[model samples]
Target chain A: MNIEEMTSMERVLATLCHEEPDRVPFFLLLTTQGADVFNVSIKEYFSKPEMVAEAQIKMQQKYGHDCYYPFYYASLELEAWGSESVFYPDAPPNAGRPVIKEFEDILSLETPDVFESPGLQKVLKTTEIMKKHSGEDIPIISVVMSPFSLASMQMGFENYLDLIYDDLDRFKELMRINESFCVQWANAQIEAGATAICYFDPVSSSTIIPPELYRKTGFRVAKRTISNINGPTATHMASGRCLPIVDDIAETGTAVICTSVLEDLSEIKTACKGKLSVLGNLNGIEMRHWSPQQTEDKVKEAISKAAEGGGYILSDNHGEIPYTVPQEVLTDISRSVKKWGQYQG
Target chain B: MEFEDTLLSLNRVAAKNIISSEFTGDNAFEVINEIISPTLERIGELWAHGEIALSQEYMASRICEELVETILPADAPSRKNMPVIGITTLRDEHMLGKRILSSFLKANGFNLFDYGDMGPESIVQKVKDDGIEVLMVSTLMLNLAHEVKKLRSSFDNEKIDTKIIVGGAPFLFDRNLWKEVGADSMAVDATESVEKIHEVLGDAR
Candidate 1:
């Protein structure tokens, strides 16, 4: 079989199966440090379509990553609802506006419009750029904020939790608005040629909310949004506490599940079973700070545990290291994949 | 009866936070002062009854820093007759109990020289150079608790008479840790911590 003629899906499937691909595919989510490493700013990368295209190509060439996300995070959609953001030189822009100044503010929030809103349009333009250069050679995955998280952005993180107890209806209304925004954002990305949508709900993780509330408010919205998306959809809850909700998340029509530092990989795979792909639980912090060999060991261990079937993707579970993770370490990980990622079963 | 009632209330609050995960910030100071402090007065009631789990109590002390974020005053307090206090945590520790204490002392009309998260050497230098009237060090983890003793011994070595006040989860629970550290005194909570400082200042004056 000619691997070159196979679609991006086929290439990804081959790699997932631990089979020799046309080449090993690597994923880059154009984070701030990632953009800086490629000599581009967030503004420059997002503003000029060609700049984004050039950076994506450069990052792919520079790191030889299999998957590429054009932009880093989905919280930019929060700006559509009149929320504020604080940008940093090296971090994902953080929401500055507390969405819920008062409990009453939730009732007045309208569902954000992705097509017309400025922030959403920026992402839309970025997605368009991603589609143009993707050349059907690789998948361009995009992310969306979960409803509960977007609600936190709308009402502010601390205030949203406080308001949940004081007022449930208004909180539910805000959640509905957040859900609408997620759908709107997902649809826009799909229109702009996002191959798969990645839903990231850090707030829905157990550290912030209890398990019952997660299943009740956040899980349902996440499920519905993934089901509504046209192509493959994956959702990531960045805390281990979300482990209990893994089965529930699988039922949400996601093709993939990603988690952060605090999850047991085997359990996540077991929970999702045959329903979805299990991406990663490699400690990103370790990769960033450890020696190249240590980083390779972590990658090897993660692959050993996660690579039983052709469903696991070797990647970090959280934010990329600023300057610490050596390019050589990443190369070593990739080389090890080619060396060790054979499906014996 | 009053003292018993306060202890009962404090226990109830502590239990609610631990068991049900219900955090009530309302009247938190009163709960800490009227109940938590008085309960601590009962020899070793806090550690004995396990009202303070190692993690939760340490976290509670850290949350005191959050209170500072919310309770920033519009204008700085007057420096007249204010005591100068130096606060630091042990090396590489991120627990914010010392930070919280510094914030409160500054808010309550004390001039603070906050060395932030520092080693014993850094803390001693700050105390000496800043002419700090009281040297306050806090640690949460058991390993970093040794730095308190090192700070006190270093001050003794220099013959620099600085009042040492140690408070945090580790010092509060580990009864022998205070004597081992050779620090002048210790307090279990922010309210008693302030009172201890006042007593030290009165003696100095």
Candidate 2:
């Protein structure tokens, strides 16, 4: 179907199936950029999911992109675990001192059910409200963070690194709880009517943790989280170090892999081929602030190289589009993709 | 408890024995440069090859830092009417580099206030509170534009004249970025830091 005929959901589903739906799909991460969508304070945006959804929907309606992600802050998980974190205007909440102060606290740790937990329930409620507002038109992603990333939140990033060597068996127990939480949370969102699960493991980037250690300690949990999810899934792995082990993550049955600009898009295309649909590598970090003409040129560059066939989605790859970037400058990316990312078939 | 045996076995006990007894004055600096630097570099190579994990690397780095501390001459800090330097790694940046850099500064006869792990604001406040002359910031990640920019702005607003020196992996990402972020000068390694500070401060003088 052509762009005019297919609804947002149809276009995205078609692309995920490796079929061209008249134009390339635009699925952007609207982080602090949502501030402009509402023109309200950042506090309101974080406090109310309705505001967050409204900002996302406005962008969706404006850009006519193929997907929508209900906004989530990485700090919400930390809050649920009984840690105090301070939130910046645009960034996610910062993990203060570790919540797991003692080994006994870790032993008493239990994976809170998503439906019952307050923090996750708030997110689930937000997704439900967002899905209702969008009328289930596009692929609304429930952003599920990786277990390892959540584990870092509980004990602080530096402390978790030390705990791995300080107490290996105890650390494995922590990993087990974290994985259980990831699966429960993602599955709950799927049940809450999210069309797909977007599994993001920002920490698993081999730069922070060696690939062998990542795979041995927590890769299985990552695999279980992705494999157990009921619907289509996508993953965004950050850092240049993550490039070496992208295929290992790709093997975990994620349908789509979103790459940062640090890796060669052509290399990733070669690596995933038929198995994984690819998104991002638009130099979104720097390009989001460029002029519309510049944004179009970068989009064209990505298209010519990575969009030879179907199965490629246009994305910026960052967690949240910075608020400083103009909305028009970003929409210009999809506008350029439609112009350049068309298929002959 | 010999240096050769410690180098082979990675034993801190043997290395500490040599650092404690047969080291003084100029000979102390030479032995550490020849012995400690090579051992740490080898460990760093193992880390680069993924032969060791981050925790193991941290422990190894701690051993080196302790060795440097134990070997310092009793009269080193008291002898200096030197510029007071404050050093810290940016919040979340690795501490191994900071430990090494501070050792180099201490070795060069500077009075340093080592503020272990601090965010941009805390370090800036420490600079103001401690009457710090030179501020050293180390960041491992390539993106520290926010931290560096905020620190520069804070120093300016507070009317503080602290000279900023930056090091670590990110500063090396772009040659001119350190200056762009308002650093007075930049250093690539521990030893270069000592020389760079003296040169920059001497020029200011």
Candidate 3:
């Protein structure tokens, strides 16, 4: 494979297809951090789709990462359900208070049109803008929250868990409602020009739930949602451990699985061998303090473990990189990937 | 009714029945300290080991909280002389850790002021105004966990002697994070929080 001639989109696509790209593709997953790059507050960054698009392009160009996305934050999805978000000067916005204050509220819940919801509209518009600017060179990875994960934000996390154990039927009913919105929103992003859909579902992580509960709930929901998505899909657990359910995640039909830092990269690669492509395990929490040399060492290690097989994408373990991580470290990561991610004949 | 099994399975009715039939006002504290606390600890262990789902641990804690509230006498004199403790989610809204710890502390007859969610400045101000001796801060994200360092500095500037205890995913992920964030101690779960408070407040309490 002549790696230098490959575009970022081709590089990522080649990897997803289990073929050697020019080099191992790397994604920064710079979501809220784009605000910092754009020199705007997080609140202001999400307000304008143009700003988000421009920031994403700038970030990819600056870091030389293979992919960029239009995700602002997970809570942005909750806005469609009438939940307000609390923005910060530094961090990503969090869902203010749960919309469903009581169990009965789920009955009256209506799935809002994705095109009509302001937050969802902004994401779709951002995707369209990125598509227009980047064209087919760079891949635009759009994100959609899995129904089970979004349930925690819809109601309180504890309340959602309570609903699961307290009234399994009601919880399933809630998941049904959330699944509709997820499908609509995911398809809308695809129509807007997303290269692939990243199904963000942290709740299904073995760290959060046992595999049995996941098979009964999140697994079913994800399989159905991914089947309905218009584009290829990657299952992301937002840095939650997925080794116990790696097989189940592969069974969900996603093209790739974004693993967690909590698990060993070599083990993850071995588990994902032929079932799915792997995209992560870098410790985002520790990335903030890594020296340039340390960052390079980490990158080299990840490539050595997973990149040789030709089905890996280097990225921070958590879906989104923290805004606190220094620019120098990110640059080092991209440089190191280019240096050591080459495939030998 | 098997109290531990009832809480584990999340059978609230069975749990309530056990409390009504087996628990009396006199044995309330003993029941909480002996039966309820240990059962929740086992559940926490199961959760930490990935043996049970988080929902089971959370619902178990919730059920235990309800049972504790029902059995414990509200006007118990032991609640008055305990340290003035305050808990809050520092700049992050993920409340499972805070809620669980708050309930666990309250069940132990500690006077706790649940500050729901607040920024660093508000938290500092509240800590000073409430004269909280031991402040427990819970944050689910790493950046928010970093807020504890800023909070610690604020407390220092104000010359407040409140000892800070942090518990959350970040602290658990990074074992030394508590000390790095200037917290006096870090508790892995609610059960450990009680012991940490005792250790943090030593002779001063």
| Candidate topping DockQ | 3
DockQ (C-alpha based) per candidate is: 0.07, 0.22, 0.56
* Each model's fraction of native contacts: 0.00, 0.09, 0.53
> What CAPRI-style quality would you assign to candidate 3?
medium
Off by over 4 Å in 1: A2-8, A14-26, A319-324, B1-205
> Which ten contiguous residues of candidate 3 chain B have the minimum total lDDT?
B72-81
Q: Which model scores highest in lDDT?
A: 3
lDDT of 3 by residue, A193-235 (tens): 9999999999999877778889998999999888888889999
Model 3 misplaced regions, further than 4 Å:
A1-4, B1-6, B13-25, B79-82, B107-109, B120-131, B203-205
Give interface RMSD (Å), model 2.
Answer: 5.1
> Can you write out model 2's per-residue Cα lDDT over B81-148, one digit (the tens) per residue?
66788887767434556765665565444578988778777787788889888888876543453477
Residues B1-205 of candidate 3: C-alpha lDDT, one tens digit per residue: 2787897666889888877776766787677777777777777777766667666666777777777777775567646777889998986879988887876676666778899888778888888788899999999877789899889999899999999999988787668889899999999877788778989989534
Q: List the candidates ranked by lDDT, beginning with the highest.
A: 3, 2, 1
* lDDT at B185, model 3: 99
The per-model lDDT (C-alpha) reads: 0.60, 0.69, 0.85
Candidate 1, residues B1-205: lDDT per residue as tens digits?
Answer: 3433323333444433432232254443334344433433341234323333222232333333333333332233324455777777665233335644654454344567777677887677767788888878777544466677788788989887889888765564345566677888887755466778878777532
Worst 10 residues of 1 chain A by lDDT: A318-327
TM-score of chain B of each: 0.62, 0.67, 0.90
Better of 1 and 2 by lDDT: 2
